[model samples]
Every structure is written in structure tokens, then in C-alpha cells.
Target: MKYFYYLLFALLLCGCQETKKEKISRLVNEWENKEILFPKNSFFTIFAKDTIAFDTVDCDYKVFTYIDSTGCTSCKLQLLKWKGVIAKFDSLTHNNTAFLFYFHPKSAKEIAYILKRDNFNYPVCIDDADSINKLNQFSDEMMFQTFLLDKENKVLAIGNPVHNPKIEKLYLKLAMGESYTDKPILSQTKISVDKEMINLGTFDWQKKQQVAFTIRNEGDQLLVINGVTTSCGCVSTEYNHEPVQKGKNLKIQVSYKADHAEHFDKTITIYCNVPSSPVKLRIKGDARK
Candidate 1:
């Protein structure tokens, strides 16, 4: 009986382990400076103005993410927004930013049809089967998955490329070899919040409830936000990593998903050096089935 109990406990622990997708999701706004595996592949075609091979391109600041169009319409729309966001950056930006789209089609004809129909004016890779399978390992439907990786391939940010303009600026700062600091070391401090509660309105059962508010430091001291944690695992929060100077601002985006159609009312506690200390942020909304 003792041995059986121990085995059962081990099995329970194994079942509770977070999957790869969850691990990746947690990397949002973290600059771990880790390298991601870029497999060599021969099944890719580019429709951009310049005929560049996938393997030859650099990965200094690659947008390493997948866009599985086989999902819902909103996801497809977000993908389109990403494409537009990438297009805004000129060739000069391309030197550092590589929009790595991962696609795995079962048939060559399907691939041809997609390419011919979409006429995507950017680089696309026919990701290896192993990579495709690894992504599919995630149980949830992949929607507008985007990971902003630094030169070392560490995660810098996640979500749509244009989701946050400041993120793009932060990427430029890193690419230019400048450390991100909101204000001078000596003169940095105050806590200013634009809103305490943000109404997300309504989200479809398939959609995640997301909203953001501006956080500013209104005093002459450096405000260091150590972390922003939600009430539960289904709620994911992201914010800037750099110091918040007296004059500068940072946006905190909060998103949550549920297993059923119901009302969501959650709070995210923000831990920072400011006098506000731990600000209790709230989010309320209705998610329809």
C-alpha cells in the first residue's frame, strides 16, 4: 500500500507539470537571452521583392512565432495585422528584424495554393516536421503567437508585433546595444496610474479577454516594478522590464482565459519600489460561449 501511494503521488506530480506552451507563455517580457533552435530546411519559398533564402537570413531579432491560419477568424485577422506591422518596417529594419513565420503543410499543392492566394510579401519558412509537431503539442488553439527574440534568441516579448509600439522601440534600443533605463540612476521615482480598473467589455468563448492601462512614475525617483502577478494561472500579465522614470510611462497588458462561458473578475497585484507599493489592479468582463 505504501509503494502504491508513492507511485500515485509521482503520477499526480507528473500530470501537474506545465507543458512547453505554458513555459513559453511565461517568458513574456523576460529577456533571458537564450538561443532558440533554428533547424535547417529545404521546403520554403519567399514571395518578397528580394529572393532571400530562409537559411541565409540572420536571427538577431527574429519574430519567432507561428500563425496557424486553420484556426478562427480573429486569429487570422491578427495575423494580417502582424503582416502589416512587419511591412511598415523598411529594409533597414530588416537587417535586425526577421519575421520568421512557421508553416507546415501536408501537401505541396496546399503550400502552392496558400502562397499563390496570399502572396505574402515577406519571408516564410516551411518549418521542419519536428518543430511543427512540437507546436501542435500545445493543447489550445494557436492564435497570433508572436515571440520577439533578441540577438541571443531569448524572448523579449510575446503577442502581435504591433501590439505595443514601445516594444518595437525597446527592440531598437537593444539592437543598438543600449541598455534600457527609464531615467538616470540617481534621478528616478513616483507612482502614477491612469486607471485602476479596465473594462474589457465582451470576449467570445474562443477569445481571450485583454486590456491595458498606462503606468507612469510621477516623481523624481526610479520606479522598479519587480513583478505583476494575476490571481490565477489562466490570467497572464505583461509589462515593461526597464525602470520607470519620473516622466516616462509603461503599459501593463492583462489577459485571461476560462474553461467555460462566464463572468471574469480578477485582480493583479503590482509590486514596485513606488510608494503605491502593491497596487491592486482589477479586471471585469463577460466571456460568451
Candidate 2:
């Protein structure tokens, strides 16, 4: 009787272990098939490749060269080109290793300097003639895919126009000889705002005009406005000192001083954390003596 009880307990523990393993396997499969969307107006794609069964696709590539403030150059180029590349694809055909390159530059001038300093000697300008010919054998629209390739020119991953960070994590997991499962989809925050275009009409010297607008934060996240700037110095704006809470409205006050007699058209750009789009205010009027 004692032997039978021990055997029963062991069987139960093995059954529980098998159940956990099956759940993990299912999650991994789901992650492998997950689809990610690109950020607004961004062009990139992200995906994972098994590395053993994929091949490289033909595409025009551009290399981004980085030069430091001290004139030291860091050359890292994309293996795939961007020609005839669309933002969508079913899968990659190559089994190549992909690497993520990170760089930090203070300004756009540094980015430009690096490109010019190198005289474009990097491989970002190359295309595989054989791959190009084979890719061209397919329809033009079919040439839009970009794949991450291994050192041997095998496709390890594929993406469209947007890069997927989850896919990158998967690659990292594979490199570390670890397994990863799909993450649960998180709820997205929503943002909504009221936009208006104001016509200040005309103003005389020493006169001021008031333009009123409301800002509401409808997203789950807090909205932060870093600053407000005007195209011309004559215009000034003010917002409520308190942040507009979710489902609450805040007022924006813009005042324009007609210090000079001239025909003026100006714009106020509101720099905010709202991801839907940036808020733009238009102010137009003529100053009379």
C-alpha cells in the first residue's frame, strides 16, 4: 500500500510538469505568430526567422554613417536595400543572423557630417546582383520585403517598413539559448483634443487680441505640454497651470500684441505628449497704424 501511494504521487507530479510545459509551448507558438503595427507614419517591420530555413531577399539598401563630435567615425550599414520595398510581407526566405545597432548623436549636423566624412564608402549602397535578379523574377510589389541575414547571407528574420522590438527580443532570446513566450496584449491609451483655427482679423498698434481654445486629455496616460512657441515674437500664449486630467478640459489663452504696423500671419506650435498628432494653432491678422 505504501509503494502504491508513492507511485501515485510521482505520477501526479509528472502530470503537472507536463501541463506547465504544454502551456509554455503554446505561448511560444503564439509569440512567433504575433503581428505588430508600425508607429504613425513610420516605415519599418519586425519579425523572427528560424535562421536555418530562410534565404535573403533582394532590396536596395542605404547605409547610415555616424561620426562623433571628435570626428571619429562609426560605420554601420544595413545589409538590405530599400528599393521597391513596401511596408508589408508574408515571410522571409533567408536564414541569416540579424544584429541591432545603436548610436547616439547630439544633432542632425553630426549625422550629416558622418555621411560626408566617409564619402559613402560603406556597404549600405550595395545590392546582391543574383538576389536582385531572382527577386525581380517576381512581381515588383513582391520586392518590398526586408530580411535580416546571417553572416552566410541566410535570412534570419523579416520585416516590412517598421521594426518590431518584440522580434528583436526573440532574436536575443535565441542568442542566449533561452526560450520566450508571447506577452499578453496590453490595452492602448486613447487621446482626443479639440482643434481650432483662429482668425484674429486685424489690429492696431498697442492693441491686443485674445484667442481661446480648450485642451482635453482623453487618453489613459497623462498629457504633458513641454512648451508653446510662436512663429513671430509678437504672439504669446498661456495654458492652464494644472494639467488637464483625463475627461477634464483645460483652457488655452493666446494673446497677440500689434507692436508694429504690418501685414502678419503667424502660427503657434504646441509641443505636447499627445501621440495622436501635434496641435497647431493658426493666427492671421493685419496691423494698422
Candidate 3:
């Protein structure tokens, strides 16, 4: 009777497990039909032309770049190049493509100063809440982020066009009412970690400690981890979500605050495009106040 009960319990546990694909499917379906909100800006002015309203600007393509501080030299270059290339075509003249830049919410002061210093001749708007972030339907980490949207505000591609040929090609093709020739983007990841559990041993309750987990792209394709969720509020995380090429590694730093004197066990659930996503990481230690 004991043996039979054990077998039944094992079977029940196995049935409760979710496959890798099911998680990814769930993530995608959540935002598939969600409309991109072009939230109104706090202030907007054209560098050289008449001011325009957000809803009044009509175009088939909208390129959004988030800007704050001007520390990224490459970002400046990309912005310049984008302005030059986009200038050859104007939405006012029925070019069907519109490229606009925005301040990353509360960055208007810094961004405005930089634009003036650089003699930026492009349309820049102030969105104090980074409203454009909503367009990121499939990823997290919005720094240096850009999105290519269609007339109906559908996210067609998610990337920085600075010097990327693929993005430029995608833009030009779509502008001409054509489709891209490349394979569709997966927007998913196949990743594995070096360790599933981290043992912090013993620590003082008032002290804070951090442990690092090395995440690797073990598949033959790209690996993307968009978001991370913790089981407890006492734990926080920092990580890079850049596309992890095959064989490459990304590290996630988990910081735990020992506020209570007890044996602690915590889990960090990460969101990614993987076969077995929502990867759960474990951390444990004894804390003494």
C-alpha cells in the first residue's frame, strides 16, 4: 500500500509540471492584441518646423528612441545617422515614414540641453513617464531601447537601428509596402544556468549580500530573458537582457536583505523565451540578528 501511494504521488507531481513551450506561449498571448499606447507628451516642439500634436502626426512608420543623458557616444552617432537618413523623406510630403525621438520620462532637462548643444534638427518630445515603454511587448530593460511601429501601432521590430543593416532594410522595405525577406523573429530564449541553488552559508540579519548566477544560451539560437520576479520582497535582482548568442553567458545578480533572524529560503523566477522558462532560482542561508 505504501509503494502504491508513493507511485501515485510521483505521477501527480509529474503531471503538474509545465513544459518550456507552454510558458513562452503564455507570455506572447498576453500582449498579442494589446494596443500600443502613444501616451501624450508633456511638451513637444519641432526643432525646425511647426509644432505638431501626437495624434495628428500621421505616418506608416514610427521610430521611437528613448534618450536621457548623452553619455552613449554610439547612441549620438545613431541619432545623427537616423536624422540624416530620415530627412531625405518627410511625412509631410507623404513619405509614409515618420521618425521621432522622445525623452525617457523626466529626462527632458538633460535631453533638451544635449539636443540644443548638438544642434539636433529633429522632432523631440517630452514624455515624463516614459510612456513609450508600453510598446515593449516582449522584453524588459528599456535603456537604449528603440521600437519600430506600423501605422496601427503594431510593433514590427524591436532594436536599435544605429548601424544595423537588418533594421535599415526592414525600414526601407516596409516603407515601400513590402515585407522583410528575413526569417521572422522568435523573441524567445533557450537558456540554462550554471547553478540552480546558491548557499550563502551564514550572515548577519542586518547585512545585505549578493549572489551571482551565470545564465547561458545553450541552444543554437538567441536567448532573451525579459523580466525577473522574486518570491519575496526582501530579494531584488539586476541582470542584462541583451540577446545572448549561442554559447554566450549573462549573469544575474540577486541581492537579499536579511531583515529577520531565521533560516531563509527564497526563489527568483525569471521570465524568458525558453523551453522551460519562468526559471526558478534558489537561495538559502541562516541569518542571525
Judging by lDDT against the true structure, name the best candidate: 3
| Residue-level lDDT tens digits of model 2 in 65-95 | 1112222222112212111111112123121
Which stretch of 10 consecutive residues in model 3 shows the poorest summed lDDT?
6-15
Whole-structure CA lDDT of model 2: 0.40
Candidate models: Cα lDDT each: 0.55, 0.40, 0.59
Q: Model 3, residue 132: displacement in angstroms?
A: 3.8
Of candidate 1, the 10-residue stretch with the lowest lDDT total is: 6-15
Tens digits of per-residue lDDT, candidate 3, 25-108, equal 343344333445765543566542336654435676776566543343223334445655576445433667777676553344
What lDDT tens digits, residue by residue, belong to model 1 across residues 1-289?
A: 1222222221222123457445434433232333455554434457422346565346466776664535322223234445555665435465667766666544435544445445555666655364753733422334225555666665554443343343444445555555654332343357778999877778786787777878878887777876564554356678889987668889998877764676767777676665444567888888887
TM-score of each: 0.42, 0.34, 0.43
Give the winner by lDDT: 1 or 2.
Answer: 1
How does model 1 score by TM-score?
0.42
Model 2 stretches astray by more than 4 angstroms: 1-193
